[model samples]
Target: MKLTSLGIRQKAFAYSMTTLGSSLINSLFSFYYVKLFLNRYRISEGMFHQAQIVFMLWNAFNDPLFGYLQDNAKVPCCAKRHLSILYGAPFYAIAFLLPWFPWRDYQEGDWLCGVQLVIALCAYDGMLTFVLLAQCALFAEISTKHENRLQLIKYNQVASLVGSSSVLFCGLISDNMENIFNFQVFALCVAMLAFGCMYYTGMNCVSQYEHVEKLEKDKMEDASNLSWTSVFYLTKQIVTQKNFLLFIVMNFFQVFHLAFLNNFMLIFADHLIPPYLLPAFVKSIMYGAGFICPQLLILSSQSLLRKLGYYKIILSVFYAELLSATVMLVLGPSHHYVLSMFLVANMVMVSATFSLFNLPLADIIDADLLNYKRSFPLSSMVFGTNALFTKPAQSLAPMLVVTILNQFDYEKLKDNFTHSEQSALQDLHGAMFYLVCLTPICIAVLQILAWTPYSIRDSHTDVAKYIES
Candidate 1:
């Protein structure tokens, strides 16, 4: 039996604590960590992108092994899912901030480049792979009921909003890093304050029967410690499903669109805002919009999914992202009040897109269980695949922005162009439109195409067929 009202509340709090805790620290890393590494180390733009590509390749290498082990790996007393989170949490926390602080400074040439590469391996590859992949796979263990699983996602998302929106606290810390906080001192505080406390919080979840079943299946799969060869065999079996394979392809394209829009925003602020403070303020305004947008979007999602269907919702969100991109481009480095309207629209649309996109994952999961006569753990699939595609967008998007930046040679600014320096505004415009609108447009079409042939919904009628076979 599931927990009662108070019991569920308590468990929710515990899970929320872990979600909020890690998200809080990760949020700090996201907003300030890039500026810290870029400015403090004076790393070249071209090189940074290349490093990200290398990190993606590392994921390609490790995740099949991870997905396999996570699938077939078992725990003695506790659930394997919970065990994965607990054991990896410490390593995850450590590697997360590894890039935030370098052991020592490197010379800014051949030697420095080599050192940077090592740090990327130690920091980006290590932390992201462990924490994200583990936590995402950890979702499968949240609840066995389909609706309950989706509710768990809601709780996780709320924590995400809290964590991400509260990033200003860290921004202030970064500004004061030299004068008061210092480097390791600040890192220690956040690490202890966030991850340490959250680790304790995650321990409170009461195990359920589904968790027990997973453990038993894992034990049946392999009698000893998980080996690399075993994981590959499991993956080969899992991906043979046409529906699952198509979903993966669709996910890659749409998520690539998301990654593109997300990573390229820096270019907008860089090109548009003449005053540094103003740009940040503009960006910060969007955070507030992002904070509330998801909740509001979810209100209509159920009805929408019931009516026009999930696929249509996905396509609509894609168009919304595109509209957001187009509005920003027309507004361009010019600060008309109208621009803010476009921006708020952009935020709402992208925020809503995430909410809309979430409903289908569980639906697909259910479809998988109903059709395949076996369970596929999807937690790893979501985040692990995301990290895979993210490498290309993170590296390439910035490079695209930087190439535009190279247009500004201070000496010839007035003579070469019409009024003032070009400020790479056109590049920013092209990037935003391409990422949010154009890319998603293509992916959205592909997603529709990929899913059209698969009739898992219709297969719901085949319940007796699988049993009778």
Candidate 2:
């Protein structure tokens, strides 16, 4: 299915909000508020970690429930794609603000910390889960073609970068508390901007009308007659194929690594250098490069992957991550933070490398259909489906970071960085270091290992034959 020039432009616009908006909102909170909960607020590290863990434990049930709801419910034309984002935008924004609202004025209480943590726990886990999962899945449900899916994700990321960059750039101008630069004002502004775009995109982006040949299927109810038979059929179908199992595992790790890295970046930036604007500047500079480079790389690589194939791209991204981690581990703190040259270079390279490889995850669904004869209505269940595993990575990385900071007592984070911040960070430095460095390397190694048997060079199209036969 070739895209018209206009079609491509519309497609890009359709997914941009999710791409841009998700990155902006997710990155800001991941770094600051999560840190605030641990550092300045003096929340118990165990309690913080426990709160996060409980958050994930709840989502274990909740993610699937949301997915089931998304899959089962019949959304009308516009509502089909946009409702979740529309409904969620305000809730997510406010959920973020809630912890701050209570924490700022009511800093002391008979159970001040306890009350704050409970509010945050509910905001992040319960309310957040619905919005995050629904919004991520919206990207997939909007399109089905492999090429279109690539464009969708590409622009989605563009929106993500714009949203994130605006935040970092604004961080440069205003104190978040005072809104000197009108930062929260702007976050709200874009919430309107992107949510409006989300709705508009869903309205005009793609042709909703398509016809299908109906195939008879049994009722989901009638457990005795239908449940066992359906279960056996799916099991036999799945067991007959070896690759599907492998695909699921690798896809799981892919989501885990992506989420893990995103969660780690904020805290890592905060400590490795100065806080707020400085780190945001360095991050923006790096991500700015990332924003441009990977898109060009992926678009151009259409020719390369045609000749060189997708496996090479996957291997390259894995190796790049491995190399970046090693550099970070070796460089430690030798470089200048003021210039942030070291950090910026590390970021540009790591981010570009991740972006370059990002396409294959989309292609994997393509690869799967080609390899194993499974055709997903939306490739999202393959892509964002890992939202289940990685959402916890969101909570899990912080839990680990806080625990280490508490354990190490922030020895490295002490006077070398700042006397005041030392206790806050020192209180939790060990946790941060392991989370920022060690966990990433471990995740990369696992990704590389997964890629080993994931070879599809020869049989990338095995599923096509099944369709033909």
Compose the digit string of candidate 1's lDDT tens values, residues 1-469: 5545565556556666666767666655544544444445545555665665665566565564455455454553223555555666676666656655555664433346535554654465555555445555544445544344445555666766666554444434443233224555666666765666457554665334244566466555643654656555445545666766665666665545444444444333343334444555555555445444554565546455444555666555655655555555555535534554454455455545654444454445444455545534444544444344434444454445445444543123312223653455344444443443344445556666765665444321222221210
By summed lDDT, the worst window of 10 consecutive residues in model 1 runs over: 460-469
Q: Give the TM-score of candidate 1.
A: 0.75
Off by over 4 Å in 1: 2-10, 74-79, 105-110, 117-125, 172-188, 206-230, 276-283, 287-312, 327-348, 355-359, 375-469
Which portions of model 2 show Cα errors greater than 4 Å?
A: 1-5, 74-79, 82-93, 103-145, 175-183, 206-261, 264-266, 274-310, 337-385, 411-417, 420-437, 455-469
lDDT of 2: 0.50
Quick one: best TM-score, which candidate?
1
Cα lDDT listed for each candidate: 0.51, 0.50
The superposed Cα distance between candidate 1 and the true structure at residue 8, in angstroms, equals: 4.5
RMSD of every candidate to native, in Å, equals 5.5, 5.6
Q: How well is each residue in 1-469 modelled by candidate 2, as lDDT tens digits?
A: 4446576667578656555555555555543565455444556555666666777677555664454444334443212335565566566656655554444543322247655776666665554566555544544334434445456655655665565565455454444223423655555664555555545544444322121112101111222253445534533443344444555555555555554544445446556655654545555555345334444455555655545656676767667767776766676553435324433443444444455343444444445555544333333234334455455655665565545554565523533456656456543543554455565577668877776776545322232322210
Worst 10 residues of 2 by lDDT: 211-220
What TM-score, over all chains together, does every model reach? 0.75, 0.73
